[model samples]
Target: MGRILLPALTLICLIAARYLADQVGINGLPAPVGEWIDPLRLSEAAIWLCMAWVAKRAIEVALRRGRNGSDEERIPSIAFDFLGVLLFLVAIIAIAGLVFDQPVSGLLATSGILTGVVAFAVRDLIADIFTGIALAIERPIRIGDWIQFDEGTPQRTGRVVEMNWRAVRMVTVQGRTIVFPNNALSRRDFVNLSLPERHFRTVKRIVVDFSVPAERAADIIMSAIRATPGVVPSQKPLVLIDELVERGTVFSFHFWVPDYPKMFMIERQVVENVLHFLDQAGYAPSYPKLEADIAWQSVSEIDASFDLPDLLHRVPLFSKLSEEERLNLAHQSKEVQARAGQALVAEGDAGESLFVVLAGLAAVHKSVEGKLCRIGQVEPGQVFGEMSFLTGEPRSATVIAEIDSVFVEVERGAMQAIVRENPEIIDQMGEIQASRMNAQEIGDSTDGTRELDDPGFAEKLVKRIRLTFGQPG
Candidate 1:
């Protein structure tokens, strides 16, 4: 009803304007300076056309904002309507001037000279406008695109927020808005991170001491990445031995993420998971260690004794297990030893076991085209080989001992036996594993690390203990 009334009101205004214009005549005498400039020889039909043109333009603007139509359909229609308005006004004025015996040729010639001067003065502005038009047509960078400009020392990376006739605006990761001239952008080297696809590859580097073999570090990093959220397994990750630094070997793991907007969050998760895994595996990132001048004490003078049982009790996985359950699991878990430079597990090898590190450090590596590369290291208390154990598949990568290490090996049969003996334990384990696996499928790699600390698991374990003793769950 509003739309119909609007067009009706526009038609009435057009009729009034045209009626007044026809009364005044096309060659009317000039009025005083303060008087309004009245149209000469305006007709009802002409006035209606103008009113209809304006209404059409307003409707087009509303539709554009709604974003209901395709660019191909909407843009050209708007352009045509705009040009029609321009032509209508120009033709009306020229025709009126000619009907009144006024010289429009001279006016047009003067206007042309003025337009040329203005164009010359605003050459750069014109260039920017054309560039903007080109950008819109080519769509090198679209609205909401994540882009990085490689112009200066530190490249500017941001999400494109808006594009104007002369400039483009982007919001940086730090929440700063940057405006770049369209012409400048056209000439600059910029990468549309969200172009081609929304996915991007992010690389993380972990440097371990040279004493920790490179091959082992590579495997650890690769395994961590594969298990980490946001990493796409279809695009196999790469572990490159970047360089040999003075203190240690520097290695980088390059993995692909499907969403560029979530890159920062995913990278942080990967780093945290890698660090936690390395810490548990007894491997720490390499840094220069300070030497004390008075550190020549004999081996017999140093006390190395510590309570292993007390330390093990602090671990969350074992800490909550009942005494009998813990002892049972311990009995089923056999100690395996590996010396430095020894391969603990090889890539593409069959295994039906999982290892929990008890002491010492090991490196994880992956073989790419027959070349062994270091990814990262593992530390005590960390579990490895679970991938194959759970999936009943071959190992994707290899684990090698970086130092003389002791690890608790729980064979598949033993684990199955424990699960069968305690069905409740299996239920809890399944819940934890299922939740982590679901998160991985959705690219949330840190789900395993964070979700594993479920308080409900502890409560369930307590309830299970009570139930075994014929008490309430």
Candidate 2:
């Protein structure tokens, strides 16, 4: 109601001001030439004031509606801006005609001639003006869309910040605002990152010395990328050896990220992860000789070792056990190494052991008929074969070593012995097993046939329970 009344009040004030100006009589005041002041005519003032108010109201309403509605809603802003300018011009002409009492025919002729001359002189500017109107109507780029323009040489990549009649303003990655003429934008080849969808694929590449084996390099890089916090699993990050450069081998890390306004942050994170991983692996960016010498001296000769005492001391699962119990469990565990492309476990095979990866990467694949289909990959600090060990079920998937991998294998009998002695271990195992099973079930139910409740629903139920009983589940 207030929104509606404000424009009405503004119109009334404008009319009053115009009339009062015309009626003011200066009896004893000396006025300069061409400064004759008089209040506006009643009809003329009313029309002018009303037009101004209506134009202002239309602009406000259009902007509000545009923001609240779909992309199509923004079309009205262009109409409002054009009509508002037209109405304001009409009000000015009407008021001027009333003030001087001159015929409008002569004024129209003069204005039309001046407009034609201006248009002829500034054809490019006029084209840009019309192009801007077309841009507004078509909406090829919206506010906040990430776009790349002028692909050759030094490219201009930025997010659209504002659009106006003459030009579009883009805020670049370097924090500079560039104003490009609408006509120029229409002529250039531009890539709208926000078009069709608001998701984009970003590929980052890291060059590592060639001395690092291809398989080992890929494993380290992929593991680092997957472990990076902001990265999503759905994007399915891929690490490929793109090319062998003069100085080193280039590994292309490709993944999809949300097409956000500030994409430089994500790019920075990817680069940081790549550098961190290479540093951890003791590999330099350039020169194979240095990396080769370092690998040979520090890593190649290190014998396969699994510190049982350290594992029990670090892992939460074995933390509760006493030193003697940890030692006993460690004694039962065996260190196994599988070379690249080796199948550690086959689907439907009888498995009596659960493996905890200590280092290197493996993939979990299922044999559909005769061909192996990769379901997922496993990295360090992850465990597998728990389903077969706990339930004595057949191995659900084949675990294949993607790189030379090492793991600590605990036999079903040894795990059973440990759990039998410590019943608390069974409860902990049940919780872990339940979480994994739930995740697997959710992942496998792509056909919408599963009846499991969503986590959001469960969270709501838990919140209600907490509110009612003052305790949480």
TM-score leader = 1
lDDT, candidate 1, 241-327, per-residue tens: 998666567888898988666777878887886676565554679887574233333333321222233333434334545666666
Query: What TM-scores do the predictions have?
Result: 0.56, 0.54
List candidate 2 segments past 4 Å from native: 1-6, 10-46, 69-80, 90-106, 120-125, 150-156, 208-219, 245-249, 260-262, 272-473
- Candidate 1 global CA lDDT score: 0.63
- lDDT accuracy of residue 277 in candidate 1: 56
Error of 1 at 345 (Å): 16
- Put down candidate 2 lDDT per residue, 220-306, tens digits, no spaces: 676666656666557777888888776677889887677654355776877786666555444447754533433332334242232
lDDT of 1 at 141: 79
Q: Which candidate is the best by lDDT?
A: 2
Residue 93 CA displacement from its true place in model 1, Å: 6.3
